[model samples]
Target: MPPSAREAANEQRRRLHHEADVVVVGAGIFGCAIAFALARQGRSVLLLERWLKEPDRIVGELLQPGGVAALKKLGLGDCLEGIDAIPVTGYSVIYYGQAVGIPYPLNAGADLGSTGGDTKGNGEKPSRPEGRCFHHGRFINQLRQACAREPNITIVETEVTKTITGTHNPQVLGVESTTRNPKTGLREKGYYFAHLTIICDGYASNFRKQYINRKSVVKSRFYALELIDCPMPTPNYGIVILGESAPVLLYQIGTHETRALIDVPENTPTASPAAGGVRAHLRNVVLPSLPKQVQPCVEAALADGKIPRSMPNSWLPPSTQTEPGVVVLGDAMNMRHPLTGGGMTVAFSDVVILSSLLSPERIPQLGDTAAVRRAMKEFHWRRKGLSSIINILAQALYSLFAANDSQLKALQRGCFAYFQKGGNCLDGPVGLLGGIIHQPMVLVYHFFAVALLAIWLVIKEV
Candidate 1:
């Protein structure tokens, strides 16, 4: 049946009011990346951000080599140019007073496992393989600037309140947002209609439940501190110190500053801020376990009496989406423990896959529900190939490093021994950790190999 004249007029008015092909909520890394990618492809995108100022949160400081490559592919490589970001060569894990260095694969480049002949073998020098770490806010500002440079992208400072759903179907037709006046502090509600809506509001997303029916589970929390003038024994390498109540991660985030994160169990009681709780814990328990070189820095930071910032570590497994005209990306859709530092890598890889699937050449009209649905289905399955490895590794490695159980403790010892072996065993796992290797089978093989080694060691000890 044909729509009535009144209904057709209403549809035209809605389309005129919301003159965009896609409405993206949240202007964080994921949202900005998506908006930038779409706009470069000649699609009109409305990017809504709640805060106009730079965010001061602690997470999203590291970007894996794979993420850098994805950024290049998205034409946003310059985002890392002026952020004063530090190059991370590899990781140094200290277990039971012993340390082993696991570096990213020697010849690994932007694209891993591609059939480009080894440049070294071809008489050409290979570039150094490395990742990056920096202040999270600076990186975000870089991305926002990149998004704003595109002519097709519109940046709006507003807080999205809810999704405007269709009366009959489950599809999200648009979004409702509230904008506040900077001078008068008055707020006004507005509606922006679009053919598609993307939710990238990070972990505390409000629109996730409307499309995804699952909730994020808080597995643990991280207490973070900044250590000034604290340089690691090996520069450009991240340090993971085990044997504490949980794992403590230390990495140089700037030339003169290192970021230290201590994992605290979710059920554990935290001290009150007024009573010097976090400082006491660091002084009493965490400091003794850290390397001697950084002890003074930790001591100074504790004595400074600044409360360490706390962030919850949550995990949300991915699910196949059946919702039409809506897509969820970044930490909101799926998350894993940050022990592996693979969150932003996964999010960037997701954007790469999704943008390719919904490229302008493929689906010219964003309103084509059937085509977008098909692309999203493919995106979901194709993304798993890479995301599963990173997600599972983060959880599994955290279990071993945390070593809450007897079996996990054995596994932890075995893992250290495997890294000490220093051949395919070490390179393969580090490659996966660096986000260069996308194969889950390789991860599974190395994981079980470590387990078998652990079993052998336990038997020999007995």
Candidate 2:
């Protein structure tokens, strides 16, 4: 707390200064994508990672086609081809014992045609490749390796301590971090200076608190248990098993690996059961509600999995930016339920948009402060619109399975019945939110008309 102590600390930080064209915090898929994009543009980039090992828990294993297209743009899709992620063609909605699957419509190579100054393909070739679910840890590790192979990029395994700001205004100039040397276990504090500082530092970010102090209110109603080596059916697809008690989602990833998300409602008492102990409870409560064929796989998955901690349905502050010189992307800026599988897609899109705005040619035209601010503004405008839409849809979906009252059940049944006939009141918002369509309200209007028609038909039948 003394002046000398503070000066020494500042001096030490300055001594470790690292200069780059850009400093990206967090080494998840989001950060890697941005770093890869920028490095391709000949920018000297530094990527900082808080942990060397990828966190094993319930996170996005699903990568939507839009995100795949983004990956293809970076020329990293070839790297992913080696990982063997299962391509998903569509999604399924479950309610009241019935399931309805919705396939994604093809994009028709519109963007690719535009690249050559010709609008060909005639809606035949998909603009975006089909989505796939992969093991998050494996996927991230692959991306990290790909970035390491690039000459313009460097990886720093350090925990960010603070963001350096310019005096007159709160403009981020650089980042201060600390990493322990593996040989000596001695902590070495360092500074990374950059023209731009991007925060992709996950949900709990110190820099994020410096700007937007928004906290997540929606707690986890579930925990995930990942398992391997079981006679479980290869869920070549994703499925949500809805039940009266806790709904569990089971799916496959990366060949032999299987990921299971078992809902543990907040209302349920925690007795701290063993890994597979919850399986008995699940059988007694959720399994009977599912199809008979699914029961064996569910039991096998439970038996072979490890019980991870609770999964929070997290969110970010309405505004994720507080400073002028820095921008927050991915979960750092905002997040929705992973079930919708839109996290990395939004983050990757931010990379594309931000890269365009931050190009050396454009930087002179826009100025540093103005350009970064514009990027953040545009990032929010695009992502927040998508986030709000996802939140509404996810909440509605969860409420149906979470409901216990008779009135809620009746409403859910009726809604499910209507949706079965190809009705989606949230379709417009969903389309926009899912990045399938840009204008969200159009899907909303279509959904409303469908709902009205369905209601009228039911009334006529009655």
Leading candidate by lDDT: 1
Whole-model lDDT per candidate: 0.83, 0.65
What is candidate 1's CA lDDT for residue 114?
Answer: 30
What is the Å distance of residue 8 in model 2 from its true position? 31
Per-residue lDDT value at 143 in model 1: 94
TM-score of each: 0.92, 0.82
Model 1: worst 10 consecutive residues (lDDT sum): 109-118
List the RMSD of every prediction in angstroms: 4.9, 6.9
For candidate 2, list the clashing residue pairs, or say none.
222-264, 428-443, 428-444
For model 2 the TM-score comes to: 0.82
* Model 2 per-residue lDDT tens digits across residues 99-211: 77655543423432221122255764433326777877778888899988876777878999988887886677888889899899999987888878888888766666666
- CA deviation > 4 Å runs, candidate 2: 1-17, 94-96, 106-129, 167-169, 227-235, 269-280, 304-309, 317-322, 365-367, 384-388, 423-434, 446-462
Model 1 / residue 77 / CA error / Å: 0.8
